[model samples]
Target: MNVNGGRPQLSGTFGAVSSTHWLPSAAAMAVLEKGGNAFDAAAAAGFVLQVVEPHFNGLGGEVPIVSYRASTDRVQVVCGQGPTPASATADSIRRLGLNQIPGSGLLPAVVPGAFGAWMRLLAEHGTLPLADVLDHAIGYAENGFPLLTGAADAIEVMAPLFETEWLESGRVYLPDGRPPAAGSRFRNPALAQTYKRLLREATAAGGGHQAQLAAAEDAFYRGFVAEAIDSFVSTTEVLDSTGRRNKGFLTGQDMADWRATVEESAQVRYGNCTVHKPGPWSQSPVFLQQLALLDGFDLRRMGLDSAEYIHTVAECAKLAFADREAWYGDPDHGDVPLGTLLSAAYTEERRRLVEAKAASVLRPGSPDGRAPHIPEQVPDVLPPSRDHWMNQIRNGLPTVVRAAEARTDTCTIVVADRFGNMVAAVPSGGWLKSSPVVPGTGLSLGTRAQTMTLEQGHLNSFGPGRRPRTTLSPSLVLRDGKPVLAFGTPGGDRQDQWTLGFFLAVTEFGLDLQSATETLAFHTDHFAASFTPHEAHPRKLVVERDCDPGVVEELRTRGHEVELVPEQSLGKVCAVGVDRERDLLLAAASPRGRQSYAAAR
Candidate 1:
């Protein structure tokens, strides 16, 4: 819906924020408009998201950000990825008789790092006072803004996912136990107070941004923040039932021990542009593999919207992701050969296997691991249909759609300013149960317990002081020796699919940022190991209301199970680009969710 009607006018002076929710984007861009630099805008945006996108980023969850400092030409990768307490190891859990992980247990929550990550950005990159940057979030929290449609939908979806106490969620969500109807104002004085406290804490650091950041991180993880959380979690029955000693590691040591920094980038050539992503630990390398696999194709002759082109892409994506699922994980814990996977020689071999006519049975072609013997085919599950005449499956089978919704994920935002400072951030985490805000501090600890595996020997197995392996990867791409595109989407497994589609739409097919953002999207569910995609494909592809149905049918005939979703169906994705020749910044933000905004000074 160009319901935002027209993009705000652009000037040489530019600033913007892209996120799943509109309000946060607006908050960040507004900060930029008022002279705050990229770091200031991001911190402001992060706080606002904690309110508007509460389900995605409460004080409880962690954040991992990749930022590039233009002046120094150095890229700093902040891990802010959370760690399980020094106490709760997979070996510790195994001492008990229970062999399987409980679906809703609290034993796995790790130390969340989002707040600390924000603190560090302010320390290293920002010039403005932390309190000043946080002012907008505090006001929004205390004064209440009208509920946007997106917020309302997220709440309705969250009802079945969170525990009863969460019905309150302080004030960002429902105060009276009902999600605000669209357009209702919502304010949580509790959250407002929390923001105010952080501002003071930042000010007390009494040194440059670095000292202030260190202090802020300490305030949350190692100091008063951890103590308060430990107390609140102690009162919760979920903790007792999960059979954990105390809340996993929502403590100071976990935070104190935590270190978020950028890893080395995997460099791959994408035609004229050079592709870069932090490797092995991140699945971003898969994008490079897919593009490389398709390098031999005559994309220009395939016609941008034709079925043949879509078929090859769908098949190529499945092939790339099939490799991802079998190989990707924490490199320190797993044996993912990051360098070999991106090698041109390897990708070229994989591409030769793709038959020009028939759909190949999808499978993991590369040997990234030492698991087994034969090459195997990955199965494709049929997408579900809401209009199916048969309500129940044969013999009373339960629906996969219902099963998958139990695993909703959030979105990613990537912004590059004219000054060349940039950020790649993914925001996520939600629970049907309440994550207690450590008592007096009122900060809810993140429930990262499920991210770990119950098996003691698996690389990603649960462990004390180890960060759970996550699917939250946001990547950056540079064309012709300059950063041109920053893109990502939110869906545990669907991330690769959406990102792949958007990239081809822009780089190979020449679509504008808006068209690429609005283009058809689908994913192979291999990562989740279940066929439940956010939207079933072949039968489903999120398209604008104006897209032709015949086009949808053609996609289905070519092996894409197609279904039509809401106009703004795909995850909200925003990107900033440069018309390198014109020296103009091009930015676009999705109107899919509430409170999204972008501004160019």
Candidate 2:
């Protein structure tokens, strides 16, 4: 009955695995136990998450990874976010009488990017073969595993749509023409076959580990999987969130032309600690911005769960997120003033907005005399929500509507091995409810195209072969040039906000990993969302119900539109930290959803 009741900090001298799903956590630990390093464990864990948490992620999703190699003594990023199809354009959507990309459908489909990223990680950094790492996921998919109640309920909720609009999905998810009951064994033999064929193709190529990994990547993008995806989307027009039937623009060529890229980690130093995140394409920089703004305040003096601490952090989040809307996007698209935006002077100038009360306006600083590119109209098509769509899957409880809107959901994985290798990855997109299952493949195309904007000249504007500005941001932290932490969560817009809270809990309040994760978290919907319509609810703050009532009252008095969420229902953060000085690996997973797990030793 303790609100702070999460698994104790999982400590070990060998290795650790923490993930959004327990099945994957166990899989990763098993891999580590088999002498695989962090990359191998993470890759294995990520694939397992795709199979078990279909409502959240899949192989068809995107996975952005930040990893540290003990040999290289460096942090690197794998940009798994896929670009729009060659034919994707605003005019094309306009021709279909749509102003924004549909939240769910084929029209918003992008090149499946996760499989490529995972393969690349395994090929470049992992010691295990593609077949060894993937066998764990294939086993569960083929032999069957217990379905989470939330995933089962999701299938049930969408049964009507799947039955009539997305028959392919109905066949894949509801093999018996009915939703799989929670706790009942559910199998996806199609996906298992798909993995088996990929492994066989790679093995048949007769090559070394790297070459075989290359063959697996080739097989997925240039072989059968791509053909199946292309054939289904090219011929089938399915109903989507836009209330219309539409076919996808993705082609085999798009998948072939697209591959995950390696990039330098975006970083900012705060009090001897350098936090690293993916580039402008993700909402990660906001965490750094928040830290900069908070540098002028005495967070520890205010206390961890104090009203002043929560209010100040929430206000800084608003300012940082507002800038995310105005500026953050694919850096390759055009010039992004990241240097000026993350500058200390910029934070000092923007820091003045955080007064005693919440500021309701969207204020993005004009950096280097360039006016911010704020969207003119933000339709609240599917506004942000804290609804527990997969509550049953996580809690084995009935559905509860906490909000009136929705967006894409994701999952995360973090691994640390005895050799000092570490990895943090957020694998997302291709939610079962987001799009139809590709016929005969048990794979669903991602709707990441919804993250694009229609505004021409904007960094996130819809364009062919341009990566959409994604919300899938993972973070890695280093102290004294050594990898110390690898962590992330699955909340779309709330990802950075919650991550910042966890970081502060460690650095400022000195809470352990488990305690930090279980600490009461609050989120603000004051800035634009990354999903379709990109709705913004100015001054809105949703605090966990377990948060002190006095803090809630204080926030309300400070001009915040306070909404209380049920206890253990906000962010699902899973994190792992390495304490080399003590020869120990520490890990923690949020109990909010009950599915997150941490395994060590």
Candidate 3:
């Protein structure tokens, strides 16, 4: 049906790359053309995204990666989501006169993990030198690139705060004492210099590729970058969503103590494909849980985008996310009953909850006879309105309302090389609007700690050195024990839901990547959000305006508070896959935001 007009699904035998921005996609393809594999291409593209999509991600952000290496014939997850500081306890936070963690400023800062995670990927799997992988990003930061309208709008919206409270940010974003115009060439010399210095130090101490990568990691986590972060965070008190200024708890020790780890992926078999995700620490498992529930239904019989299909998917999402709020947390800190959660018996028990009409309540089931517990402070019902500043800080993504509004969210990258290796990564947090730019560093600390709750004994309760259950999730699919597809998107809590729709379209409805990406998208905000204030809009089902009016009305009649957004406003999904049977690489990117692109040789 050419739902997305004429955007071609790129296919090649050499390599394919798809990312949230054109520059990153180009950079990744360039790496592949230069003989780099999927892992190397992914690392190169990831760094460039930190430069071009500053409004969406930065050096201080977090990224959770799912990759399939052909050599090992294994699917693994890289845990880039950093843990809270050793001093950041629930008691310490409450002592600061705050019930919930603020969404912005230093109080919610964690040990920045993006750089470490990328370095780990490169050192363990990549063949290229650190300098080679980072060159494209450094060039963009130094020479400047055309500013995205969304980035410009974010700067404009935060200009008052920058000028008054965050002077360091003003010095960078407000280059001429004002926000740069959209489409104008914008540069971040400070960021460029930061990258250059890291490279120089790495080169000076380098022995080989691995040694240089290790040196770069040390430079960021234990050397000058750590020193800068420590000094700034300890000395500065900044305004946040709590309506007060607070100093951060993070220290140089926190950064030094943290390292990205490669762990086994959580998997669930659906039809012929075995879907994999990160552990319960992230919201990744919700994807598998949803699939488990849907495995009972014949979605092909229900048809695509039909009222029946939308209802079933939305209901399953609500149930799965309820489990996320009740049970998902860092496995390193506590027990997460992932095995029981994905069990077929549990699936059948939960699948029965999906009825003829929409369920307006948030229902989390008992896994293995264990009762579910959510934070007591989290409201079951949505409030009419919230504080403006609190709303602004929720997801760290920025939005500016105008005649043609500009909104920037997270970033996604997926890569596939001819060697059968594939990578899917979602890089988010540390947005320019989320917190003040640290002095001397061109990046800001992430507000991911805001996802932690103060409710003690709860699975996701706040604790020192504990990892926050983040919303950044990436997906990888394998058929017959071979990696075939890698895909992800850039919505915070809605990430899994959006990508689930794309996956179902392809696997169940026989749609191609581009067509599946353009399919009408919908998600239920029926569970508490992972962001600060953790609000839930009960029974709310938001669909793109392009959705059939009949379907929208049907959902409303079934007890959903249907809200319609503009066309192409839901998810910016990017994907890459290998047609193993045909020996071809395939790639596609969402055309919604006019930013994401797909490239192939």
Candidate 4:
């Protein structure tokens, strides 16, 4: 199957929004049309994603954004990934008789970061009022939007568990005691009221847009919302993926103490472009590392999706991610030698490991003589396919609840306004079945704490007020000190690998955004997962089925543990680019799952 022709890349002179879902894309474009900047449009679209794609993300989730403000010609990262509760420690999990934090449950929850992070963006960078920014989301929640097939299937699979063990979740997901039908107009009046109350509180506390957004943040972290969350977590116990009931560690104090901060991005100059990503707290820098390794290779000549191209890129990803397991963590807790890691000298040495044949092992280079440190009891099991359970539903109707596992599957948005502002943000966690919904609030706490380690001295080990090294990395690219591209995807460990391919497609092959997105891609499980159980499959390469069969055979001949996935099932990527030379704005979305879309004027 040829993997190239679908809709053409979207082009315009005004603005653009490329998101994992259609409705949010439209919502963002609407904001841009109303004179909102990229930040405001992104915030508005992000809130709508919480309402429509609750199984992937929610208001109770986290958002890590990398953006370029055209006015300042600067790149910045907004860190919305909050820390674990103060009481959460290695000892805390040991007390629960668990070796690793379960993938889902209150024990794995952290302070909800999405709301606060969005507010910070609005307060600092946006032009729209809080109510105006959130109006689309609130309207959708109160009235309705068509339920996604994937979300419906997820609810169907977890409905029984919610009813029996997480009754509050059942209240929201299975209103009227049944999973909402796919394509049905699903409404969550409770979540609508929750936002309405937040807006009202903001209005009560405000004199201006920035002040009102600050008040909204206060409402979420310090006022009635905090009290409700504390009450539920302190009093209730629920079964997690580990099959044991546990109480959460999050408290009102944790919420009040936590706030999103802006950080300098990790970046690298390759060829004519500079790529920027969030710090070690996220998996962003790994993409830069991959680019550094590929600097010596002629990727354009190797050709897109060819065996040589896929093999080289996938091998480099394995090496970079290996370093992630050994070194990347919240820099607030320890020193991360990012400068040395991204140096040409270091990457050249690491690139030597990529062989003509795929290496059937995990090889992480020593950055500054630091041996890669993996936890002793990390899970090495294979995870369920991202599409496995979703396929079980019949006729787009609800299916039976059989299993509940924490997935790193998230959502992404990319926006570019006429004013030169570009934003790439990944909002994830608080998946519908991850934790019980807070009573009276259509929200669930994030299971990001599940990514932390119990092993002492590990960079990502659990501790009070320490952010987990999250997999939610977003990317922004600048050319000759000017903002140009914003891109990201939604897949657990594969987020970096997929976006790396997309970037190379643009910079190397000179494809437009849509063609770059449609180009076949490949991923690897060679490094440990960033989610619970943290499994690793040394040298395994999963390629999309649309790739040439000859290339697939050649990849196998080279010793990769090759696995073929259904076409367009690997990454739900979206991207937007500003063509300064042409004075045109460009956007594109992957056709995978038929949900991703690009909207532009």
Residue 193 shift from truth in candidate 4, angstroms: 1.0
- lDDT accuracy of residue 24 in candidate 2: 96
Candidate 1 lands at a TM-score of: 0.82
| Residue 258 shift from truth in candidate 2, angstroms | 1.1
Best candidate according to TM-score: 3
lDDT of 1 by residue, 1-601 (tens): 2322334423344754576666677777777777777778777877777766554556667666666677776655666667677777655555654343332334556777778777777777887777767888888878887765545655554443233433234333556656567777877677687777766886887987667767777776667666666655445544322323333434555566776655666667878887666564555667777887778788778866566676677667666766665566577666676566667776776777665443434466555545521212222232353522121111011111242232235556666566877776776543223243344443455555554555555545566666665666676676655676666666555666677777787788777776666665544432333111112232223333444566666766654545455555555556666667777766665554434445555
Candidate 3, after superposition: displacement of residue 454 in Å? 0.4
**Candidate 3 at 30: error in angstroms?**
0.9
- Once fitted onto the true fold, the runs of candidate 4 whose alpha carbons sit more than 4 angstroms away are 1-4, 378-408
* Candidate 1 deviant stretches above 4 angstroms: 1-12, 91-105, 153-179, 239-250, 356-362, 366-369, 372-409, 430-443, 526-568
Clashes of 1: 37
In model 1, state the lDDT of residue 509.
76
Q: Against the unseen true structure, what C-alpha lDDT does each candidate score?
A: 0.59, 0.84, 0.87, 0.84
Candidate scoring better on lDDT of 3 and 4: 3
RMSD from true fold, candidate 2 = 3.6
| CA RMSD of each candidate after superposition | 6.0, 3.6, 2.4, 3.7
Higher-scoring candidate on TM-score, 3 or 4: 3
- In candidate 4, what are the lDDT values of residues 430-517, reduced to their tens digit? 8786777999999888888888889978788898888998989899999989888899998867899888888888889888888888
lDDT of 3: 0.87
Q: Which of the two, 1 or 3, has more lDDT?
A: 3
Off by over 4 Å in 3: 1-4, 378-391, 394-408
lDDT of 2 by residue, 1-601 (tens): 1335546888998888899889999999999988899999999999998899898888898999999999999899998998899998889987876667776778888989999999888877989878879989999999999998778878887787777878888888997899889989999988888889999999999879988988889999999999998888898888666555788899999999988899999889989799999999888888888888999999999988788998999999988888888898889878878888899899999998889988989898899988986876545343333433322211111121234322225899999999999999999887787788887788888888887777788887888988888888899999999988989998888899888888898889878888888888878988766665566789998877878888789889999998877776777889999887887999999887778999988
